[model samples]
Every structure is written in C-alpha cells, then in structure tokens.
Target: MRASVTITGSLEDAFNEWTEGTARRLTDVTEQAASTMRDELRAAMSTAGLGKLGRALGHAGYPGGGNYSIHPAAEVFVRGRAASAAKWEGVIDAFNDGATIRSKRGWLAIPTKNCPKGSRGRFLTPDQVAERFGPLRSIAAGKSVLLFADVIAGKSGGVRKATAGRIAQGRESKLTLMFVLVKDATIRKRLDLDAVIRQWETRFPAMIADVLKDG
Candidate 1:
C-alpha cells in the first residue's frame, strides 16, 4: 500500500541520482502495470463476446491513479459476483437512483438535463493552447522564474493574493512573470484564457521551452 525510498548521498547528488534512476524506474513500472491491466481487460472483453465493450472497459479502468469508473457491463459483472451480489445490487440501485460515485481524485457528479451550459466537451491541443497563450518563455530566466497560476475552481484566493503581494513588496524577485487565468461564467470567458496565454508568449519570448496539458 505504501513504498518509501531513501538515498545516501549529498542532497544535490542524491536528487540527481534519484531523478535518473528510481524516478525513471518508477515511471516505467507504472506504465507497464497500466499496459498489463489494459491487456487483461481486453482479454476479459474478448471472452465475453464484446470486444468493443472490452475496449471501452479497458479505457475506463484506472491503472495507476487512484480513480476508476465501473463500465455498465463491468458494473453488471461485479453485481453478478455470487459473494458480493447483494452489496453490488445495492450499489447498482443507488447508481440508478442518481447517487454520485466518489473517487480519490474528486467527487463524481452526474450532470442532469438541467445542468448549466458549460465548456464540457471542448478541448485545446497543447500546440493550440501554446499558440493562443504563447510560450511561457520567461520561466527559464533569472535566479528562478516563480510561476503562479489560478487552478480552475481552486479555493486559494488568499494564497494567490498573498503571493502577488509578496512579489509587489520586493520579498520575491521582480523577474518572476505571473500568469493568471480568470474563469468566467460563460464560454466568452475562455476568450480571455487565450489572451492571457498569448501575453505570456509575447512577454517572455526567450524562455519558451514547451507547453503541457492536463491529460
């Protein structure tokens, strides 16, 4: 359930060694485990005469992260298990009665027909996001480029304000370029997201390396 790693070396040397060795090994192991689980799910699906359903089941299975969703078929299968049948039946009943599933990552809320219109299905490729926002170029310069951004719906307004205040009060370096994305109620607010990203691209033209997206 838990793993701990320890390295005996100078701090810098230990960090560098760990980054190259254990960190890379952990990443590889995690990926392999996920792939194996996918294969197992695929095999299970094939045996059930539901290859498409199997593929979907594989996609829904969480391999590394502590989050997963039971596909409709998987839910049925779990409910059919002789030992856990009653418990699973209760779960199925709750799900049918509109109960939200909870996972380690976050609460799972089922959207209803009356749910407010929002950017649910929209996505931006890394390149498109970068092109719109420009490269976060300044992040590479000076003693350190202190990066700050508002996580969507993050409850840390005071933290953000204090961070900005610290920079203003000369407690933090002026070389730090701040990036703030305001989430607005409407789709039009995302137009602002594009502009804020572009400003970063324009301001720190020299430091642009790569842009990443939350998968």
Candidate 2:
C-alpha cells in the first residue's frame, strides 16, 4: 500500500517559510508517516490474531523466517513551490492475502506455485503442529488417517496423557482457527491517515519555527 500526503495553504510570507521548510523536511515528514504506518499495522495485525507474524515484521530486512519489511514507498516531492508531497509504502498488511497448500495430512505448507508475488504463507512448522495436536501414538502414522481426541479430564488435577485404548485412525482433524481472512479495509481503518495528516499539520508550524530558529 502507498499513502501520499500533500500540504495545501495560502501563499502568504509566513506560510511560505513553512512550505519551504516542509520541502526540505520531506524526509523527516515521510519518516514520521512510515513510523505511524508501522505502529498502526502492528496493532492491526495483533487485533486480527496474526500477532505472531506482526512481531516479526521489520523495516530493513528480507522476508524469511517470518521477518518482513515496511519501508518507504516512493520519493518525496515539492510541487510548484506551493505543495510538498511524500509517499509511504507498506506490505504484508493483508490477512487473506496469500494462498497455501498442505504439505501433509496435518501440516499446512506454502505451495510451490500459484502464490501471490512476494508473499509467504503463515503455516506452523511440523513441530509446532505436533505440539498443538500431540504426536501420533501409533508407530504407523501414514498407514491410516489420524484425529485428535477430546481433552480428557485429568484425575485429581494431574497432567493428562493418552489413555490405554485403541486410537482408531480413520479421518484427519481440521484446524478450525488456522487463518483469519481480515478485510483490507479493516486493517486500513487502524492506520487513521486523517489523524496522521492532522498531526503533521498541527506540528508543521512548530517544526518550521524550530528549523528557522536553528538556522
């Protein structure tokens, strides 16, 4: 995603000072927008129940082992000596953005093809899935299908374990809460671009004054 901020105001002398300062301050201003996007996206992912991946998101790294980037989207520009514009970029902000295929009967894996460009699947590792749904008690796993039984209550608050019974491997258990398809607009709502712009506008004058004072 990309967001552009354009500053508009009367061309008075005082305002000219601010606009000139804004042109020079484009980098810092765009950085602030990026910062806002980062924070907002993190919160949105958490709310969308993808907090694990969100925690791994970064600004300056290749996407692998859950690490992703949300760097600057485009170049900053000063248009006609009257407006200053900057674009902020984002990726990995979608919940239902990619496709995946199961590697095994239980393990959900990223397919080798038919995936969105620059996208990675958020499937758990085999070990993780085993941990959540205990490892097969049977020695022959591939011989038959497997399913998790209900959590049997432990006696006297002790830890529960598989009871001495035949675990009939007939069908595979489905992961109910595997992935959530949160809408793009739902994630965008948290960005609150208007608030970000308003904040920048509210502080631009003071920022320009400080620059002038220092100059």
Report, for every candidate in turn, its global Cα lDDT versus the true structure: 0.35, 0.39
Question: Candidate 1's residue-wise lDDT over 112-204, tens digit each?
Answer: 221222256434332333343334332333422323222122154212222455555554322223332222111111011233335434533
| Tens digit per residue, CA lDDT, model 2, 11-107 | 5976667655544454354445545555665666677665654554343212224322222132212122222111112334233343232334453
- How do all models score by TM-score? 0.24, 0.32
Backbone clash pairs in model 2 (N, Cα, C under 3 Å; residues 3+ apart or in different chains), count: 1
Positional deviation of residue 205's Cα in model 2 after best superposition, in angstroms: 18
Highest TM-score scorer: 2
Clashes per candidate, residues 3 or more apart or on different chains: 4, 1
Which 10-residue window in model 1 sums to the lowest lDDT?
Answer: 184-193
Once model 2 is optimally superposed onto the true structure by TM-score, how far is the C-alpha of residue 184 displaced, in angstroms?
25
Question: Any residue pairs clashing in model 1, and if so which?
Answer: 133-197, 133-198, 137-207, 137-208
